[model samples]
Target chain A: MVRKRQILVIGNNTNGCTPKHEKIAYDIGSEIAKSDSVLISGGLGGVMEASSHGAHDANGFTVGIIPQDDASFANEFCDVVIPTGMGLTRDYLNALSADGVIIVGGGSGTLSEACASYMHKKPMVAIKNLGSSVDPYIDGYIDHRKNIKIIGVDTAQEAVKKILELITA
Target chain B: MVRKRQILVIGNNTNGCTPKHEKIAYDIGSEIAKSDSVLISGGLGGVMEASSHGAHDANGFTVGIIPQDDASFANEFCDVVIPTGMGLTRDYLNALSADGVIIVGGGSGTLSEACASYMHKKPMVAIKNLGSSVDPYIDGYIDHRKNIKIIGVDTAQEAVKKILELITA
Candidate 1:
């Protein structure tokens, strides 16, 4: 039997996120997990930790792909810890390994991963007003937005709705 | 005449070095600026802010490729702020545009950028004991290290020395 691929949450560690983003990510993550979608993240702090926590609380499997060798650094919520001795490339692998990518609040690092996702033709979802540098793809530019699927939602429920629709559809 | 390229420091958002990393990144940034190297960062707080402050104090150009559109989110030291509107992907460009990459105290985000530099085949320098990762690469996993050249040094002087040596040699 073929194992189902997981959903990669390409989150940002920028200034950390507000309570709103945390709530949104948590809600969406929980919903996604209830649907039996496996969650993966950078396994540190910020959205990765938040999403993992949400998934874990929902009794779903979570994977934290850490750049360091020590599993001690893995997110407290991760059930499976894959320690990559390769440093930051672990994030790249996280993006590449995902069947689809969802970007929560982010900074330059989030944008880089999005670019990689775009370059690799991966489906992407952006939580609106999350304050990402790539906000323009959804907000400002319409033509460029069509090149890649940029799904924007106001609520976490809607966010998960769109994500599930895109993935399962 | 070809314009000289700048040195971009891309690494973890967390100050893995704590109070010491702030001072170290500041010192190295100042030195690099004095030697006419422009400093670039992910444009968030912590090391990004510290190094930008150092370059600014030296009256050198400091560029912050921020993930957000608002220039106010950037540190006060930034002279050139590229509002990437791309989030973490902006950090990837910051690494791509650099002649070389310097890693200070970093976490997963920093590791991601370092890996990008490696994939892009850029020369890199790491502040010894500053990174939780890179130990394996420096020890003997030259094959795992790939096309990028990795050098480890204790002092800012040594980092500069090794970078110059790699460049000149």
Candidate 2:
């Protein structure tokens, strides 16, 4: 079987902002899974759990890039847990391995991972105003005045559609 | 002035989580700061922001290890931002530069960074339930547990005190 391209969901893992962000994050991840995309995450809680859960609920494949050998840290929804044995540096591999990236409401860690996606020239879509403590870091090139389609959308479905358009176009 | 020891806080950067987790994370960082500790992080969200803010609020310093050239991604609380321009690999340096590591609640990305900490033999403390989503992995340690301090604390204050007691002792 031809393997489906994995779309990594990079997000913030903050307790203060996660409860509200989880709703939209889950919607986007679920939409992506419903579209047959394999979900990948750092494999724990917050957006990772929501995204992993969304993909699993839709009967889609999910891969969690975990930091250690233990499976308990793997979010409950992850189908394949790959223990990186690398620690926080595993975040680098997560960003590097993805076909593209979707940045939901995020903070520094998400921003760092998103920068990785941008640096690797991977297609990226940042979901803005999802109730993160820190505002989304918008690339100047993708500003509203510009026609550059490093798309930004409010809903999950639209974000996925825009990502597909950018990738396939 | 005696320079504060830099304690690197490494872990997953998912969407913001709970205020309780943030409070715990900050409590640990603040405790470290009170001891003249300089906080370090991947320069982004979740525990990183919470910890950095805690240290900064305590009149301590913070350094953010950023993967991109732009320092805008650094949290507002960070006193200094070191742009690595090396994408996700920057996380490795964050792990390498720390005097020790305090893992707040995290996923795989945090796990990966934690692995780097372990590999380097840096003293590391996981805030029990609050640090990383290290589930089954936490249970598999048949040996070599002596080198790592796994403290199951209900609050960040205890976690910080434990980390200080271990590294300083």
Best by lDDT: 1
For residues A100-168, what per-residue lDDT tens digits would candidate 1 score against the true structure? 777786754565566566645666788887666556565322122234566777776776667677766
Q: Model 1's DockQ?
A: 0.04
Candidates' lDDT values, in order? 0.70, 0.69
Candidate 2 TM-score, C-alpha based = 0.52
Q: Tens digits of per-residue lDDT for model 2 on B17-118?
A: 468667776776788788887888888887788888888888888899987889998888888999888766875788788777777776545654554555
- Models 1 onward score TM values of 0.53, 0.52
lDDT of 2 by residue, A1-169 (tens): 8977778887766443466567766876788888888888988788888877887877888899987878777988999898988666677788788887887875445644554555466777877766431132344331122223345677788878877767676
Candidate 2: Cα lDDT at A80 = 89
Model 2: DockQ vs. true structure: 0.07
- Deviation in Å, model 1, residue A88 alpha carbon: 14
